[model samples]
Target: MTDELRSAALESKAWPYEEARKLLKRYPDGKPGGAPVLFETGYGPSGLPHIGTFNEVLRTTMVRNAFHTLSDLPTRLIAFSDDMDGLRKVPDNVPNGDMLREHLGKPLTRIPDPFGKFDSFAAHNNAMLRDFLDRYGFDYEFASSTDYYASGRFDDAIRGVLRHWQGVMDVMLPTLRAERRATYSPVLPVSPKSGVVLQVPVEVVDAEAGTIAFQDEGERIVQSALGGLSKLQWKVDWAMRWVALGVDYEMAGKDLIDSVTQSSKIARVLGGRPPEGFNYEMFLDDKGEKISKSKGNGLSIEQWLTYGPEESLAFYIYREPKKAKQLHMGVIPRAVDDYWQFRGNYAGQAVKEKLGNPVHHVHDGKLPDGTLPVTFGLLLNLVGVMGEGATREQVWAYLANYVADATPAAYPELDRLIGHALAYHRDHIAPTLKRRAPAGVEVAALERLDAELAALPEEASAEDIQNIVYEIGKSRFGEEGGFAELRDWFKALYETLLGSSQGPRMGSFIRLYGVANTRALIAEALAAA
Candidate 1:
């Protein structure tokens, strides 16, 4: 690492850098005997992977990258899937509900695949999770709870839990309701007869023997909680994983705060240190409801990708992670445009400023070239004016005129953006557009603006055109009201001429859309009035 970058990283307050600093503090000498610092992210393969799942891995990767800049210590990220978890209920979004319902209470990895593809339901979802992560080129190893337990990887941890049974109960009981506290057990034994994971009261016959007695079909059965015979409860299992894997860092949503606390205490009982992490606020749907994988209420990763580039999505995830943000289709255009703006600013930034720039983190300090010649908002506006029949050829024609020598071959990013804008316009913007006839003062203002445009020089800049627009609005509306009237004047232009309540800046729009076309739009609005 360069001295300048190392200096900046040491002082950087970006969330990823802050997280990396936590690891530095944890292992001042960088893990004794040169063991790689282990980072983990947990996934429940009960439902399909969603945007939230993507956020965890992506954010964790960002932190891992930041840690590399700060330290030369080797690091590893494990995407751990708790597929051994019992199927509590059928998810609403999956197929073959009857098949899934029949398999309820069984371990997810044992349940028959609802999609008829993978061997089990968890297998299907785990593959989906891996594919999702791989699609984004995330570097990590995949770990399965079922495999870990079946392969004896978690045997020692399970034995440790057996030895500290009371300690585990003490940590967990207070967090549960009275009804739950009565029956909760650190060990969940899989029924030999039924093959279902049974959550029943257990009596520790002997901690040394790793033996537990529990009721099964009115019979008291003695079982060894080892070698896939049993798995720990969610909280206890979390602690066991930490002890077994020696996890250094992990993070979770704010909703898991209590779970993390309870698990941290359990980790202490299991003779392990809890991983360093922060609780990021959850993503909410358009209605401000917390998004759920089962309910599938928010925008999916697929949906977001369809409307914007992955870097834009990464940029959104990188910003204000602790602050709650609404995840919806409406946020896409701005995210796409904002990503490029940040990338554009990255070139001119100092090293310290670069450390703070989100684009730097989004691309792991390797930023791509080119600021978008036109904003996404302007592209959407162009699509709005061109109507549903607008083609890529048609859009590129206008783009070529506005930006000399521009083409799809030269600007691949803009080409992708054009496709995204077209889709967004067709699905979202088109149906909502409702042009109104100009009334009274608006009609005269529209007429005057049209005449002014007709007399403008061919080479008039956007700023020059903007000045003319500002003067027109100020002259027409300044006397009656100040800023409010000026805002209303712009609103009037949007509502009457563009059929929208909001739009791109008038000068930029006119320059790209051609002044003649804008004048024709003004004439149409005035004639209707």
Candidate 2:
């Protein structure tokens, strides 16, 4: 690392840098001969991987990348899947509900695949998680709870939980209500007969021997806690995984705050330190309710990518992670535009400023060259004006006219964005359009704007057209009224002419759409009135 970059990274206040600093403080001397810092992210394979899964790994990677700049220590990210977890309830979103219903209380790895692929339900979901991570080219290792348990990789940690059974219970019991406390045990034994992961309480017969006695179907049963014979409850399981895998860092959603606290205490009981991490607020749906994998209320990873670039999705995940943001179709266009805006600003930024810039983190310090000539918002408006049947060829024709030398080869990002804008307009914008006829002062303003636009030269710049529109609005409305009147004038233009309450800058839109076309649009609005 350059001395300049190292110095700037140490002072950067970006969240990723802040998180990296926490790790640096933990290992001031850099991990004894440069052992790689281990970063972990947990996945419950009860359902298919969703946007939340993508967000956690992406944010964790940003911090991991930040740490690479601050310290020379190598890093390893492990995406752990808790597939040994029992299927408590059928997920609402998946297919073959009847098949999953029959497998409740069994380990997820033992349940039949609902999708008719892979060996088990957990296997199917784990493959999806891997594919999703691989699609984004994330650097990480994959670990499965069932594989670890069955292969004896987790034997030491499992035995540690056995030795500290009471200690683990003491930390967990208080948090549960009276009804739950009565039946709660740190150890959950999988029934040898029924193959169900029994949640009933167990009596520890021998800690050193790893033997536990529990009743099953009115029959006495003795089982060893080691290997795949048993598994810890989720809280204890989480702490055990941290200890077993030597995880240095991990993060979770805000809803897991209490769970983190309870698990941290259990980590100490198992003679290990809890991993350093933070709790980010959860994503909400359009209605402002917390998004759920089961309910499937918000945009999925697949859905977001269909309408926006992957970098935009990464940009969205990188910004203000602590602050809750709504995940929906409406947020996609702005995210795409904001990502390009930051990327465009990256070239001129100083090292210190670049460290704080989100694009640096989004691209892992290598900012993509070239700027998007057209903003995504303007493309959406272009679609709005061109109507629903607009094809890529038609859009490209207009773009080629507005921007000489433009082509799919020269501006590939814009080409992809054009497709995205068409999809977005078809699904979201077209359904919500509410064009109205100009009324009162709006009619006169529209006539004057149209007349002025007609007289302008074909080479009139966006700035020149903007000045004319501004002067007309000021002469007719701004001088006689406050800011509200001028604002409403623009709002009227958007509603009556564009069929939306908000739109791209009028001058930019006019230049791109052709002044003649815009004049015809204004005349159409006037005729409607």
Models 1 onward score TM values of 0.97, 0.97
Tens-place lDDT per residue, model 2, 1-529, is: 7999999999999999999999999999876666789999999988877888789999999999999998888889999999999998888899999988988999999999998988999999999889889999999999999989988898888878888888988999889999999999888899998899998989988888889999999998997988898988999999998888778999999999999999999999998889899999999989999988767786778889889989999999999999999999889999999999889988888999999889999999987766688899999999999999999989998886478778898898899999999999998899999789988788888888988998998789888998998888887874443335777878998999899999888888888888878988998999999
Candidate 2 residue pairs in backbone clash? none
lDDT of 2 at 449: 97
User: How many angstroms is residue 381 displaced in model 1 relative to the true structure, after the best TM-score fit?
Assistant: 0.8
- Number of the top-ranking candidate, with lDDT as the measure: 1
Poorly placed runs, candidate 1 (over 4 Å): 479-484
| Residue pairs with clashing backbones, model 1 | none
lDDT of 1 by residue, 427-450 (tens): 999999999998767777778899
C-alpha-based local distance difference test score of model 2: 0.89
Please report how far candidate 2 places residue 528 from its true position, in Å.
Answer: 1.4
